[model samples]
Target: MGLRIPVKLKHNDKEVEVNALLNTGFETDEPVVALPLTIASQLNLTPGEKRFYLGPGALVGEVYLAGEVTITVKVGESERSIKAYAVIEPREEEIILSDRAIAELGIVVDLKHMKWWLV
Candidate 1:
């Protein structure tokens, strides 16, 4: 039901690889990504601010903005990196790629064929 991309996150010299789903509905002013609390713990990320997350349907709750995180992804033949805010959701098990993040990464998603490529 969504586009998934490989994501590499680095924080405090700790690096981990995970798959993030591209969420077109996620509208944010900054380029950000949402990570599970467990994964954030692995990166030793620090919380910044409290925010509310609205999920599919009526699911809505509070989440912590887990400071700054480095997101690295390969675009075309080159690798790109950007700093993004990480929202830590204790109950979330999947990584979400926000629209801002997608713009920064230059990822092109083909919804008609259900595929994605780096531009």
Candidate 2:
């Protein structure tokens, strides 16, 4: 298992704080944050472009990047805006913060203590 932390997401005037797992498996240039359909709906996001995602064990799935927006995430004492690819999927249990997000947020994963902290 990977490190997970509580993150705050903001879009426009709407905001929601949820638990997000640092997804080490995701490799991409931009930060991608997977949100549930409910949360995405709350943010009033619309699908823009269709995209495909390949997960562990070759779990291939479809996603959309149509709702391109700048979302803010609160790390420790600072907040950073990231251009995130939103995934409005139905069955996801937790939000996923991709590697790019991890680095941008300066999140240090301390596996030995099973903890994560911002630098």
Candidate 3:
């Protein structure tokens, strides 16, 4: 299993805590978090425009650029927030945290133990 961490996502006045996957392969220069349509809706985010993109393992897909939101990673008493661009797709079922997001949140993942801690 992959490393998953509790994260609180906020947009405007709406927010929700979810188990977000820490995907090291989801590389991007800027902080990005991929959310399902349901989460996007709950956050009151409207899908703005469509974009063609490449994903992990060189997979190709289309996703909606649902603007930006504040992503806060919560672990015990440590928490950090970063403004990230939200990628929403109809078929997405999990919140995928990009490599940039993880680094921005000061997350150090111990894949051997499947554990994570904030720095």
Best-fitting candidate, measured by TM-score?
3
The lowest-lDDT stretch of 10 consecutive residues in candidate 1 is 46-55
Q: Give the Cα-based TM-score of candidate 2 against the true structure.
A: 0.81
Per-residue CA lDDT of candidate 1, range 20-70, in tens? 899878888899888898889889986668888777899888889888889
Answer with 1 or 3, whichever has the higher lDDT. Answer: 3
**Candidate 3 per-residue C-alpha lDDT over 1-119 given as tens digits, one digit per residue, 9 for 90 to 100:** 89888899999999998999999988889999999999999999888888988766788988899988999877677778999999897788999999999999999999999988989
lDDT of 2 by residue, 1-119 (tens): 66777777777777877778888777768877877777787788766667777777979987666465455556556766666767666577677887887787777787778877667
Candidate 1's TM-score: 0.88
C-alpha lDDT (0 to 100) for residue 90 of candidate 2: 56
Could you tell me the lDDT of residue 5 within candidate 1?
Answer: 82
Candidate 1 wrongly placed segments (more than 4 Å): 53-59
Candidate 2: regions farther than 4 A off: 69-81
How many clashes does the backbone of model 3 have?
0
Worst 10 residues of 2 by lDDT: 66-75
* Order of quality (TM-score): 3, 1, 2
- lDDT values of the candidates? 0.85, 0.72, 0.90
lDDT of 1 at 118: 74
Candidate 1, position 75, lDDT: 53
